[model samples]
Target chain A: MKRNLAQVVLSTVALLIVLSAFLPDTDGGFSGIVKSADSYFPIWFSIIAVFAFVLGASSLIGSHVRKIKDRETDWQYSVVTVLSFAIVLIVGLAKLGGASGLEGDVSDPASVLGRIFSSVLSPLHATLFSLLAFYMASAAFRSFRIRSLETTVLLVSASIIIIGRLPFASKLFSFLPDALQWLRPDKLSLWMLLVPNTAGQRAVLITVSLGVIAVALKYILGMSRDMFGGQK
Target chain B: MSSDSLLLLITLVVIAAAMLRHRDRKSEVDCIPEIEVAVRKAAELNRPAYFIPGSRDIDNIQTISALSMLKVVARYCAEYDVELIIPVSKSMVMERAREVCNAAYEEAGFSDRWSSSQVSYTTDDPLGFVAHVDGMIARAKPAVCFMFGFFAGESLLLAESSYNVAEVTIAGTAVPSQIPFFVASCDTTLIGEEFFAASAMLSGNQEDIAMLQGLDAGKQLAIGIILAVVVLSYLTLIFKPEMYESFLTIVDNLLHGGGR
Candidate 1:
C-alpha cells in the first residue's frame, strides 16, 4: 500500500511537471497556476539538494572510516582522505585567515580553505587532468590500427582532420596544381566537419531525443518500476 | 500550442497507443552480451566489477538511465556471487544506488551479500572523482568495468584506465563529445540513444518494448517531416521563386513556435 501511494504521488508530480512545460504562462487562469507551481518546484528541488549534500558528505566519511576500521586494501589512503576532509571542514567552518568572522567568506583568497583549494586541490586536479593527454595519445594509437576496412576509413578521416586543423595546412599544400587545390587539407577538413560530420551528429541527436522522450514518458506513466527498486 | 508542445503531445499519444497495443503481448529484447560476459568474467576471476554511473548528479536523465542499468548489473553480480563496486559523485545517487542494489540482491535471494560499502560517495569535483576512480581501478584491477552515464573530458581517462587493467571494458553515454572516446577505448560501446534504450532492452518487459517501438515510430515521423520540408523548399526555390520567402517563413513558424 505504501509503494502504491508513492508511485501514485511520483506519477502525478511527473505528469504535472511535463504538462507545465507545455502550458502557456499568463497572469490568470489554469496556465497561471501551473506556471506558479513550476516556478516553485525548482526552489523545492534546491532545498532538497541542500539536504542531499549532507547525506553525501556523511556517506563519504563513513565509507572511509569503514575502510580504515576493516583494514581494507589501501587503508592508508583512507587516513589521508579523512584527515584532509577534517582539516578543510574545520578551516572553512571556523573561517580561518582573512577577515575571520561569520560574515567572512570561506573561500576568501587569504583563508586557509582558499589556500587548500588553490595550493593542494588545484595541483591534484591539474595532475589528473594532464594525464588525459597521455591517455588520449595511447588510446588514439590503438584506435588508429588498420585491422579492417572500417578502421582504415577511421584512420584516414582522423588523419585528415588532425592535419587539416594545423595553422599552415593550406600553405603546406600550396605547391599542388589548381585542380588539386581542392584537396587542400584545410578545405577537406572543413568539408568533413561541416557536411558528413554534422549530418551524422544530427541523426544521433534526433534519435537520442526520441529515446529521452520515451524514457521520460515511461517514468511519468509509472511504467519504469526498476528505477524505484521494483522488478521490471 | 507551441511547436515544441505539439511535438511532445504527438509523441505522448503515439506512446500511449503503442502501450495499449502491446499491453497483452510478450516481446523479446535482444540483450547486450557484454553485460553477462562482464559479470561472469568477474565471478570466474574472483574480482569485483566496477560500475561508474557517470559524473553528473541524480537530476540528469543520463544518470537515471545509468541507475536503471545498475539494477540489472547488480542483479547479475548477486546471482554470480561477485562483488559490485559503484562510486558515485552525488550523495542522492549514492543513496538511490544503495537502495537499487539492495533490492536487486534481495530479488536474487542474496540479500545477505549486499552492503552499503559497495556504493561509495567519492568527491563531487569531476576531476577529483576521476582521480579517486583511477586509483581504485589501478589498485583493485577488477575483471570488468562498466561505465554508463553522462561524461565530459574524463570519459577517455576512465575508459583508458579500465582498458589497461580489466579484461573487458564496456561503456555507454549519451554525450556526443564523449562517444568517440568510449568507442576508441572500450571493448564495447553503446552510442547515444542505445545507452538510454539499454535498461528497457535488458528487461525485455512488454511495456518497455512497446515504448521503444513508439520511440522508433516517432523517429520515423520526424524523418518524414524533415524530408517533406526539404523537398518542398527545393520545389519552391526552383519553380516558384517568388513564394520561396513565404515558404521559409511558414516553415520557420511551424517549426519554431514563432509568431506567438
Candidate 2:
C-alpha cells in the first residue's frame, strides 16, 4: 500500500513536470503551478545535494575509521585520508589563514583552503589526469593489434588521422600524383572526421536519445518498480 | 500544440499501446555473455564482484539504467552467495545502490547476506573517487568488475586498473568518446544505446521490452520521415528548383517555431 502511494505520487509529479516542459509558458491556471515547479526543481535538487554531501563525508570518514579499527591491510593509509579530510573540513569551515571569520571568502588566494586547492589538490588532479595519456597508449596498443579485419581497419584509419594532423602532412603528400591527390592523408583525415565520424556519432546519438525517451517514459509511468526497490 | 510536443505525445501514445499489447506476454532479453562470464568467474573464484554505477549521482538516467543492471548483477551474486562491492562517488547513489542490492538479495531469498556496507560512499571529486576505487581494485582484487554508466576521462583509468587485477572487466557507457577506451581495456564493452538496451534486456521486464519495441517503432517512423524529406529535397532540386526556398521555409517552420 505504501509503495502504491509512493508510485502514484511520483508518477503524477513526473508527468506534471514533463508536461510543463512542453506546455506553452503563456498558459495560466494549472500550467502556472507546474511551470513554477519546473523552475524550482533544480533548487530543490541543489538543497538535497548539499545534504547528500554531509552524508558522503560521514560515510567516507566512517569507512576509514572502521578500516583503522579493524587494522585492515594498508590501514595506515586511512590515517592520511582521515587527517586530510579533517584538516580540509576544519580549515574550510573555520575560514583559516587570510580569511579569519565566517564572512571572509574561503577561496581567497591567501587562505589556507585556497592554497591547499591550488598547491595540493590541483597537482594531484593533474598527476591523475596525466595517467590517462599512458593508459591511452596502452589501450591503443591493445585495440590496434592486427588480429582481425576490424582492428586492421581501425589501425589504418587511426594512422591516417594521426599523420594527417601533423604539420608536415601536406608536404609529405605533395609527391603523390594529382589523380590520387584525394588520398592525401590530410584530406582523408579531415573527411574521415567530418563525414563518417560525424554520421556514426549522430546515428548513435539518435538511437541513444530514443532509448532515453523510453527509460523516461518507464519512470514517469511507474513501470520500473525495481528502481524504487519495490517488487516487480 | 507545438510540433515537438505533438511528437512527444505521439511517442507516449505508441509506447502506451505497446505496453498494453505486451502486458500479459512474457518476454526475455538475450543473454549478455559478459554479464554471465563476470558472474560465473566471481562465483568460481570465491572473490567479491565490484560494480561502479558510473561516477554520476542517482539523478542521471544513465546511472538509473546502471542501477537496473546492478539489480540483475546483485541477484546473480546473491543466488551464488558471492559478495558484491559497490563504491559510489555520490552518497545518494550509495543509498539507492544499497536499496537496490538489498532488494535484489531479498528477492533472491538471501536477505541474510545483504549488507549496507557493500555500497560505500567515496569522494565526489572525479579523480579522487577514481583514485580511491583504483586503490580498492588493487587491494581487493575482485574476480570481476562491472563499470556501467556515464563516464569521462576516468573511464579509461578505472577500466585499465580493473583489467589489470580482475579476471574479467565488463563496461557499458553511452559516452562515445569513452567507449573506445572500454572496448580496448575491458573484456566486454557495451557501446552507445547498447548500454541502455542491455539493462532493459537483463531485467527482462515486460514493460521494459515493450518500451524497447516502442523505441524501434519510433525509430522506424523517424527513418521514414527522414527518407521522405531527402527524396522530396532531391525532387524539388531537380524538377522544381524555384519551390526549394518555400520548402525550406515550411520545414523550418514545422521543425522549429520559425516564421511565428
Candidate 3:
C-alpha cells in the first residue's frame, strides 16, 4: 500500500514536469515554475550523475578487493584494474602536461602521473579504439555477402561510394555532361547519401517512434513485467 | 488556416486513422501472458537476456531509450529474482546504467536483491564489449536478451551468437543498417521510428502517445511541403518560368533569412 501510494505520487509529479516542459505557456503562473525547473534540472542531473559514479566506483573497487582477499581465481586482474585506476586518477587529479603552464607546481609534468598518462595511458587508449577499424573491416568482409536483395543493394551502394570517392573515378567519368555527370560512381555515391538516404532515414525515424511509444505505454501501464522480472 | 496547413491536417488524420487500424498487428505475441510465458521458459532454461545500449555514449537518444528499458528490466528482475547481466563499453554509460538500474530496484521495493554484479562494464572497446557480453551469455545463460540502441558492424556478431545459443532476442535500434542483421538473428525486431516508439510505448504515458501523434503531424507537414514545391515548380516551368523564379527567392528569403 505504501509503495503503491509512493509510485502514484512520483508518477504524477513526473507527468506534471513533462507537461510543463512541453505544453507551452498555458497560464501566467506556470512560467516561473517552468523557468526555475529548467534551470535546476541540469544541476540536479549533474549532482545525481556524480554521486552515481562514486557509487559505481565503490562497487567496482569493493568487488575487486573482496576477490583479492578471498584469493579468487586469476586475482592478478584485480591488481591490474586497481593499478590502472590509480594511474588515471593521479594523472587527471595532478593535471599533468596541461599547457596552462603553471610553473613550479607539484601537479606539473614533473610528477609520475604526467609521465604515465602522456607516455602510456593516452597511447594505449588510442591503440584500443583504433583497432575498431580493423575489426570493422573484418566484420564487413564476413557479413556483406550478396545473400539477399537488400545485401546486394548494400554491396553495390558501398562499392559505388568507395569507387566514386576516388579522384581516378572522377577523371574516368569526366566525359559526361554536368547534369548527367552523377552517373559517375562518386557523384552517384553523393546523390545516394544526400537524397534517398535522407528519405530512408526519415522513414525509419517514423517507424521507430511508433514502436517506442507502444513499448513505453506497455511499461508505464504495468502491462509489461520484463522490468520486474515479468511479475504480475 | 491556410491551404497548406489544411492539407497537412488532413494528411495527419489519415495517418492517425491508419495507425489505429494497424495497431493490432503491432506485436506477434498479443497476450501479456504469452510474453510472460516466453520469459519464464527462457528463465527455466537458464537463457541470458542480452542487454545492449548501442555503440554510443550515454548521451545518445538511442542509448537513453535502452537505459530506460533496462530500468524496467531491473525492476522486474529484482521482483522475480531474475539475474540481469549488462556488458557495456562506455564508462559513462556504465555509471548512468548503474544509477538507472539501482533506482528501478528501489522503485520495485527490491533494492536488497539488486547488486552491482548484475550489471557490469567491459573495456571501452566495442569488440571487447561484445566479447564480454557473449561470455556472460555462456556463463549466466539468461533466458531473454533485450538489445536497444545504436549499433555498427558488431550488431550481427552479438545477435548471431545469441541465436546460436538459442536465446530469444528482442532487438530495436534507430540505425537502418543494423535492422536487417537484428531481424535475421532475433525473433522480434523494432526498426527506425518504431525504435523511438518502443521507449514511449514502454512508458505508457498518454502525453507521449500524443507527442507521437505530433510526429505523424510533422511527417504530413513534410509531405505537403514536398508536394507544393513540385507542383509550383511544374507550373512555373510550363506557364510562367519567371513566376517560378520568384518561388525559390521567396522560400530562400523566408527560410534562410535571405542570408543577410
lDDT of 1 at B231: 100
lDDT of 3: 0.64
- Please write out the lDDT profile of model 2 over residues A105-132, one tens digit for every residue: 9799888899999999999999999999
Chain B vs. true chain B: TM-score per candidate = 0.92, 0.90, 0.73
Which residue runs does candidate 3 get wrong by more than 4 Å?
A: A1-40, A90-111, A171-182, A202-232, B1-47, B54-61, B71-83, B88-116, B121-146, B150-171, B175-189, B199-225, B228-240, B249-260
Tens digits of per-residue lDDT, candidate 2, B87-166, equal 99998998889889988898899999988888988788999999999999999999999999999989999999998899
Error of 2 at A61 (Å): 1.6
- Which runs of model 2 end up more than 4 angstroms from their true locations? A26-31, A98-102, B245-249, B256-260
Q: Provide DockQ values for all models, in the order shown.
A: 0.72, 0.70, 0.18
Q: Measure candidate 1: CA RMSD.
A: 2.2
Worst 10 residues of 3 chain A by lDDT: A223-232
List the candidates ranked by lDDT, beginning with the highest: 1, 2, 3
| lDDT tens readout by residue for model 1, B166-221 | 99899999988889999999999999999988877886777778777777777778
> Which consecutive 10 residues in model 1 chain B have the weakest lDDT in total?
B15-24
List each model's interface RMSD.
1.6, 1.6, 6.9
